[model samples]
Target: MAAVGNRLGDATSPYLLQHADNPVDWQPWDDRALALAREQNKPILLSIGYSACHWCHVMAHESFEDRDIARLMNERFINIKVDREERPDLDRIYQTAHQLLTRRPGGWPLTLVLTPEDQTPVFAGTYFPPRPRGGMPGFADILRQVDEAIREQPGAVAEQNAALRHALGKLSRAPDEGGASALGNGPLRTCRDALAASFDTVHGGFGAAPKFPHPGGIERLLRHYALTLTTDDEPDRDALHMACYSLRRMALGGLYDQVGGGFARYSVDEYWMIPHFEKMLYDNALLLGLYADAWHATGDGLYRRIVRETAAWTMAEMQHSRGGYFASLDADSEGEEGRYYLWTPDEIRGLLDDDEWALVEHRFALDEPANFEGRWHLHVQASFSESAKRLGRPRDQVVALWESARDKLYRAREQRVRPGRDDKVLTAWNGLMIAAMARAGRLLDEPTWVGSAEQALDFVTERLVDSEGRLHASWRGGRAAHQGCLEDYAFLLEGVLECLQSYWSDSRLRFAVGLADTLLARFQDEDSGGFWMTADDHEPLIQRPRPLADDSLPSGNAVALRALQRLGHLLGETRYLEAAERGLQAASGALARMPEAHASLLTALEEHLYPPEIVVIRGNMEATASWRARALKYYTPNRLVFTLPPAARPPGLLAERVAEEGAPVAWVCHGSTCRPPARTLDALDEVLDQSGGSS
Candidate 1:
């Protein structure tokens, strides 16, 4: 360790700023941190995590705040603390290394030991205790042992580093061993078979333990099922059914906050039992979109309820003072994960009458402890009718009583110590939220959600985006920094497009198209078929990251492709279409090795291709909500509905539509020519179905 002070004080990331006053000499991910260790021939100790990470905060307080640990760290290592959100490339490399090293899935507050000179990791693990208490060796002990290993057994450390690097280099542990003919029918079937093998029949989602929602997993399978169902419906529906099952499980599971309405970051157990507790804006936005689509497909009240409730939460908790959305809410409070969500039986019983309490307890199976300690996690059952029948109470009365209790408890709970609210508005996240709000507004037919979309859009446009029309990543108070990356560009573009569809505004369409052009020019990977994370003008990090992989959210390229596709359709620009097609093709080539990986990107591809229809509305569209009902009457997935604004010269459109004398109507367009504008929603429906088969 070098000293008590570090370069992290000068860092811009909120997570890094939290540690600016720490006793540990924490340096940001910069050359100075690496060069110092190389100069002193000391091993590098790298800790990577995010602001919302609970264990990251725990380890920081227990060990990094201690002077002795700081001294040990300075003496033996070039210590670096990286905010994972800011530097996802570093997070990805090390997380992959961790999973490979431990034969387990990786997560935040990741710890790793690396060679000082070559930037190669030698040893790694997650958070360790300050004094060897939590069934793990202390951080101080690990530091000493790692230092000794480097000093006494230098060869071993070097060998481990070499091996780690080699393994990371060979991305495919076993390449294309599936024996499927490249780019043919065999690959698709093979991929589908692999999907089925991992598919959970009872619970849904793929994989065994620590399952994720995996949006791309559902999107691709849904598309595959749709395409196959067109000609043959034998096993294609399996994928769709599997996706529904998993989605439903997630909706009902503790992964979703019953009270707050948004989902937690992840479930720790195999059963989606306990959550990591942080409420990320991005996760809710994605899930809302997923649930909305599910509602579209199934017409299920449960899915619709999830979408509405989630939108409500986003509007209430995640919305920023400036109108844009916040990044996340921390999972931990009082040094415990899920402290805010858990309650005791006494706490619950105090709020409810004896009969109501019994009914509620029986419904949610709240007799015993659900949380780690003796507290109960209020995961309510699917319905209270059964419990009402069991308790012989009126179903309506049972529902009313439960709602009253929820309101009372929620009010009381608000007075307690709340989790840290990261109110910094992020452009990428805001974009996703905007999309969800706008789309949900349309689906639910609520003007309030649309109002939220408008307010958020105004916030981004007024505060985050500059006069030059370029966007900044985040904003707080009067301060905003970090140049907007490709993700922000793609996501915001998607947001604006959704907004355009919501209001059917030509002005938003023009703005989105203009921004998309700018994004293409600035971030488009010239040689390859993707976009760089940052602009070409920005300073490069140690690694020049051109991310093709999707984790948690869709990769920038995937988002860009979808954005471009939507923009092209709106503007009638072949350039945008061509670029989008190229991106889609490139992404398709890399899908197999990472199926559940790029859910966002896969969702985009699924949206752009297959079972799609084009509905073109001409003339007055407001008769009998003629235009609105035409768009809203039927819930069709992936249909591009173009309401031709009253303009003779369509800005980017290649086609010409002639409206009759006065009546507003819709033209359901297929491959080339547009059908005559339909006077009623029924006529439009028939035309759309004739063009594209119904779900």
Candidate 2:
């Protein structure tokens, strides 16, 4: 019943809508806001954050909501709010500016004061409170000082802005490392060595405290391990160990939501004991693949459990009725961070009988001091056998008791005020989850999970993609908006390819081909090789950002490279292959400088060094299913599999291939060279193994 207070009321982004009632007069990033700032000759206050970001909410409540601070912001600067998820291009550009200005990483809610003329940042910081605190200047004080400096010392401000522009421009340009010919395994070796050096021997993962699940890095490690295999015991075994160790610690620690399923955004502590607790679709998607690979490597029941549970959580919480998965789950619930997940000793006692409570207390380290602000975050510390030995009870009994306790606790937690969900269906993230679901379905033999992936893919293709075959970035409330970025097309292409392998469909294959064409037409950097983050027709920002570095998620260019390589080989399209090669060349310098940092790019580089084996299983669906299953039995990190009827089209790679025997047959090829058809599952296994798991 309350009236919305600002221009954010008309915005599509949920993050922008969250500020609809703020007295700050927030405008969504648009031409009107820029024009107003230019006309008024005032600095622009650009704040970028996502809907589910906790600090974003804190800043909104502390500074933007206060009328006094709002007045200061309104009079001096034209204020704009951006949902980082909605406009990753803008976020990437400004975050880079913030780093350039402050010599540190930028995070939400990113605050910047930019010139109205060119929108180059003059000042940048993150999360300034209403009152001076955390060694940061108060929002009002900072605003006043910035305004005074701009007015009193216009020449100095202009000089600083000019310097920033020059610096940013230099940073934006890709480095000239060598030529495209420099592409090889040299960078991959450098990266592997760096990871080995930084790897935490005592704990899992690399680096020090505040460990994040770098799924891309783990994936790279897995591939490196596969590539460098020399019997069971070797020095190269370290790669597999590092990846497995990190995943093990994470699964056992608070990062993995024990009561529910899925992973939090990251751990706040080194041991993965305390998490930030926001669940993101991208994180789970990446981790799912890693875990599935881990299971394939070790045949560990724990890894399998993780893969199943994470997929289950995604399906239950993230998937929308329309089929596309939601963006994220907020870290906060009921005005408190981790409130939905944390528990008290008394609360546990109330839910369980004395024996059950006691067992759980010891098993989850609840009897130890409270880990999260005087409340317990349930994290499994002891194995059932260990707890049973200590308690003088049978292991099975302990397991039964713990399961019962967990169910009751999960049920009770469900009744509490749940964290807010950002229901916007992101095309890139859905692509990620779709890939995860499809892979898990095939690898773990879960048809329902594969079906779930197909359904989500159907939703994205129908809703997010326009009739002209162009893809949109997001969808919500039966409407799609925002032109698709490089990631949207690239990631979805990967997903569509995965679905094709899971259950071959003619329409999805056509969709994949269309997406590949669009990626070339819209996002490709014609002169310089890698793809741009935005489309050629996209609204221009301060810079045309072409980010090649890997972050929490893989780089867009890296993903684009992999997608192109796979699709090219699958379809026998030389254009896609050439584009992929160009992409690798473009990223060559950056990869050479910091191969460890460019895990995904290193992966694409590996593919160039040793092209993936392409296996086309052509026959009746019923007969070919066994052959397809056998092809995936071994862990082939750099391999592409497609199971289609004898008559599937595009007439590219599958042109001459057909069913030979009464049973299904597989045509195995390395690059353009084809091998004789393998008629039996045993014959296919021998072919794959002879190539040392992958070509």
Best by lDDT: 2
Each candidate structure's count of clashing pairs: 7, 0
- Superposed on all Cα atoms, the candidates' RMSDs to the truth, in angstroms, are 3.9, 2.5
Error of model 1, residue 35, in angstroms: 6.7
lDDT of each: 0.73, 0.86
**Which candidate number maximizes TM-score?**
2
Task: Give candidate 2's error at residue 596 in angstroms.
Answer: 0.6
lDDT at residue 679 of model 2 (Cα atoms): 79
lDDT string for model 2 (323-424, tens) is 889999999999999999999989999999987987898889877899999998978889778999989999889988987997898899999999999999
lDDT (C-alpha) at residue 415 in model 2 = 100
